[model samples]
Target: MIRALALAVALACPGTALAQAGLDALDRRSELLGWEAVGRLDMPHGTCTATLIAADVVLTAAHCLHGLDADAPVRFRAGLSHGRAVSERQLAGWVMPERYRTDRGALERTESVGLDVALGRLDAPISTTDADPFLVLTDEARGDALSVVSYGRGRLDAPSRQGTCRIRQRFTHEVLGFDCDVTFGSSGAPVFARQGRRMRILSVVSAGDGVRAFGPRVAGRIAPLQAALDRDVPAPASTTGIKRLRVGEGRAGASGARFVRPERSP
Candidate 1:
């Protein structure tokens, strides 16, 4: 979800500070992204980060799964760090509204009606130890703070092996705002809110600066999309004793793929 905002840049450029925050987030938090199977059409696998909304459900940006066919194997990795892992769950099903399609413009416009959000039902459960699900949006949260965390190798002020970033902003029923800075790999990262000991999900990463712009419109685009998700996913089934071990720590050697660690931002 992308929106046009005032072009005035902030006087205090926190590009470096903001980048550090992103890095810190990756190291310390359990952020999940929407990943796809790469390589073969049948063997597709890739990774994106997202927020756990239900015991077995994740909220992410719809574009992350846009080109993905219906039968694609979608996975969500929560509490991901340095490719070491935390939890891995295969998606039983995915839902994206019909409105999330591209509008084919230089300044892309996405609608919460469809393209701004997506929901996934995990094949298994995730532990709440280092990883847990977040709460959903509420009316009181309409003008509160939010965070966007992601793993991508874009124009980060400082680079890290973990590849993470987070920007603080305020959310309205129709918009979320802060300094815009994100890249392609960040598509499905969660826009979250932490209250006391509980973290809630408000939106999924939609769009920010692509090539030449800053934040794009994402508010009106994702709200309706999220509403649709709530209707489809309902709630996740409770599963006790979900495994707390990371996936790639001991298995990457056998898998032959180099494990990448998620970086933390300040």
Candidate 2:
């Protein structure tokens, strides 16, 4: 059997300290991950992390919205380095698969193995100030070495009100494997990598125990989702009014690699 190991790339906070921590930890694995905006869905139970896939779009776990109906207000926070952010965004709409429900047993099995994905369209294009350049996605046939990042209260709270992540696991794609260091609040962090000059996102961290487990698999199923994102979803015009940022001078080489510089506001 093809032993596929799913990698869970975590989301990050966007302050000087968080950025520095990410940069420091990223130097060795820069090609595998980048800084992303992960927000919680805000429910009585808990919260979930989210990542930006498009200009005004975020990709999170469907379970995050499972408890609420379609009309529920979906709030999001980017740059999650400090305990929270003052400049978070509120979404206009939240969409997920119709099959999902707020039940217990179904949620557990469906969360890790099923298509537990969700999408949110922001009220406007999220400012680059809070979010940053986009990350890429990995194909099914690619190798299985991933890096996860997160900003939340860990077992010890080393970062202190900032984001912290560790190398969770290492396995193949056809069969997934993980170290299970992630927890409930860590859900929705993007799993990605950089091949040559492209930042390819493979899977989003869904769920696992506190020890060692696999992340949600994302190989053959992502095609339809990618199609939906590219063809069906619409994004607002850029604040800069340009297709892409120039990043003219001070910014490092554009190898689609994740780098750390002074944080800026949108």
Local distance difference test values of all predictions, in order: 0.43, 0.46
lDDT of 2 by residue, 14-128 (tens): 1001122232222222211235344444444556667666556677766666667555677766544434452366666666554543443353343333556667766666655
lDDT for each residue of candidate 1 in 113-228, tens digit (9 for 90 to 100):
12345666667666544344454545345434444555554422211222322343433334344443444455555554444433345455454432221222333444555565
Residue 253, candidate 2: alpha-carbon lDDT: 55
Model 2 superposed RMSD (Cα): 8.8
Candidate 2 stretches with Cα past 4 Å from truth are 1-36, 39-41, 83-87, 101-112, 141-144, 153-175, 197-199, 219-257, 260-266
What does the lDDT read for residue 216 in candidate 1? 25
Per-model TM against the reference = 0.57, 0.61
Q: Count the backbone clashes (under 3 Å) in each candidate.
A: 44, 22
- Name the top lDDT candidate: 2
How far in Å is the alpha carbon of 6 misplaced in model 2? 16
* Poorest lDDT segment (10 consecutive residues) of candidate 1: 34-43
